[model samples]
Target: MFESPNELNIARKEHKHLSFSAGIYYCLGGQAAKLEIEVAFNCLCDKFKQPRLQEEPVWRKNSNMHGMEMLMIAI
Candidate 1:
């Protein structure tokens, strides 16, 4: 969702490490993985009163990955 190069660049720099798995060929199951995660999260959220974060997570951006590296959530 970052619209500018500066924003994207800053997010990418917040992390100390990076990895990329798009090697010889692209992942054939990427969509399946995404769908699976979404379904699981939706079910959990529906059953919870309030999803609370344990702490603010580091936002890391790198090639093919952009998400919380460590997170704890409770209802």
Candidate 2:
């Protein structure tokens, strides 16, 4: 048997909620706003069946908006 010269991390993980900075970050209507957005996304997903990406998304290549840049989808 031989050893491999590569990397394998089994602990590190990432997601949308993990993007925010630490501490009690708050806003006047932040909770409401997030609920609204999540509801909207859920509604869209319910309406669209198997909505898939047409191509590789161009997300935050170089822009102020860290959100989705170009999400080419086909319902």
Whole-model lDDT per candidate: 0.58, 0.55
Per-candidate clashes come to 0, 0
lDDT of 2 at 14: 31
Give per-residue lDDT, candidate 2, residue 10.
17
Which residue segments of model 2 deviate by more than 4 Å? Answer: 1-18, 26-30, 63-65
Choose the strongest candidate by lDDT: 1
Candidate 2 has its poorest 10 consecutive residues by lDDT at 1-10
lDDT of 2 at 73: 69
Kindly list the per-residue Cα lDDT of model 1 for residues 17-45, writing each as its tens digit.
Answer: 32224656656776687588779878877
What's each prediction's TM-score? 0.49, 0.51
Tell how far residue 2 is off in model 2, in angstroms. Answer: 29
**Stretches > 4 Å off in candidate 1:** 1-24, 58-69
Q: Candidate 2's error at 8, in angstroms?
A: 21
lDDT of 2 by residue, 1-75 (tens): 213212122133432342343457635566687689779868878999876667766656554435556768688
